[model samples]
Target: MTTLDPYLAARIHLLSGLDWDGIADPEARSRFDEYGRDPGEWTMPDVDVVDHAAPGPHGDVTVRVYTPPAPAAGALLWVHGGGFWGGDLDMPESSVVAAELASRAGIVVASVGYRLAVDGVRYPVPLDDVVAAWEWFVRERPAASPVCLGGASAGGALALAAAIRLRDAGSLLPAGLFLAYPVVHFPVPALDDATAAAMRSLPPLLRFPPSLIEEMFANYVGRLGDLPPLATPGHAPLGGLPAVHLVSCELDDLRPSADLLARQLAEAGVEVRAQLAAGMPHGHLNRTPTLDGVDRSLAHFAAGLRALNGAGEVPPDVA
Candidate 1:
């Protein structure tokens, strides 16, 4: 079996002995706050970043757009993941990924700041914000440019649901989809024996057990039963969607969910190109881009973006 990346394994090893569930809230927050601090250096390629307000049903949704100096290969509407409640435009998964994709793939990226599932906000609220941002981005971009939709973790669920919505509504659809370690299932499918064994070595904080999965969904949709299909899109019909590039992390509990969705997509006749990020954990994109795994994941997504516009491949330097 492949081992965890040494850097990540060392980090996880430090927390392996901690009783994550037993820790007091305040203490746990204090101990883990360092993980969220911005990396001191930001040595990414030069790109023009701007934020714009896109009209949504509830209010204006903010979209951070990144533009490359060169002509763009295509446009991507990107979403960040936080279990549907925690991420923002400033997170590395949002800003760093957008900047890298724009500069490396020569693509314009619109990172959506969707409403989180908190303070009574629930299903369809975050989805609506994403849809609104997508429509606005589509209208703003050149008609000839190919546009793709992408997200990581919960954001993947939103991106796929939005794609399905656009298809059913007879609206313009994206040219492709780029999903990274997406948690698209309700129960989050059971892991295979190999994956289960691999997960045993991870810290409690790194794991997503069944109970945690249920709690996350409960917080997301209020009630799990009689839910809208889009709430857990893995069960929804995935036919007629555009080409998909799915990245499943090797050691993630949610890897099974991504695997299930890949099968569903293929059975539904969608073109799917899936890769397992070896020796990686879920949300590795949240790490500093200097990490080898993070750069590899970014390159995989950038290559997919370039392919969406028939741009051949990512440049060697970018790759």
Candidate 2:
């Protein structure tokens, strides 16, 4: 049996103990932000950062650009995940990951602070933010060179959706996609018997009740019937998606959706790679400071970025 990382368990427990019902409250949101664990950072390296607000449909999206030492391998526009309700660019996943990818992969990392669904923010608002941020990056950087797109959880779904949208518009498609436990299946479905049984057996910190997801979906997509394949991507056609690198958490209630997406992408003849964080919880990459699982996921992300940059090949390594 795989042992759960104690740090992750404690973090999950802490989050679970919070008055989650108050998450939509401003003060409660602040408390949740403060209570979050320290997002890990990469070892120090020469990196130049420029943070600014770019034009968007609703307002402006904040974007942070990280430039690392020497020649650049390629560029990536990374989005942060927080269930479409919360999260920011300063979080470890965005800040630290960008720094690390720039240093380790020699890629320019543009971390986006897209409009979050909380504070009365809505779906298309967040999606609009990502589109604006990406457009700005492509315009500012090399339009000839391909840019990879990446995100975790909510951000991941947006990344894929945006890529598809771009394809439809005959715009430049994302060179690749990095999705970490993405919430693609909007209008979250009821967990099947087997998955439900497995989730029930998980620790309180790890167990994801269907009610929680239902609330998130309601808060995100106000009208279930209005959900298009672009908004709720689980059922979206995977034919045109770029090579995908999807990471799933073993204990996540969202695994089934990820698995479905992976299989569908493969069936569509898209190059797909999937990895699971063994004994990890949902949002495992951000739940702990730096665990073995986090390292493993990051390594896969780095390798994928290199391949997207045409620097190497990512062989079939899904499990």
Candidate with top TM-score is: 1
TM per candidate: 0.92, 0.86
In model 2, what lDDT does residue 245 have? 90
Off by over 4 Å in 2: 1-3, 6-45, 187-198, 201-205, 287-289
Q: What's model 2's overall lDDT?
A: 0.77
User: How does residue 241 of candidate 1 score in lDDT?
Assistant: 100
Best by lDDT: 1
Encode model 1's per-residue lDDT on 169-273: one tens digit a residue: 999999889998989888888888987988887878778888888988999999989878999889888999998888888888889899999889999999888
Candidate 1: what lDDT?
Answer: 0.86
- What residue pairs clash in candidate 1, if any at all? none
| Candidate 2 C-alpha error for residue 312, in Å | 3.0
Q: Tens digit of lDDT per residue, candidate 2, span 1-319?
A: 4445565555554454446556777865665665454446435457899897889888888899999877365789998888788888777777777777777678888999887787777777788889889888888776477788988888888998888888888887888888988888855555567656656755444555677777777788776566767777777777877889988877678777777788888999998888877877688666433567787788788788887667777835655
Shift of residue 257 alpha carbon in model 2, Å: 1.2
Looking at candidate 1, what is the lDDT of residue 72? 68
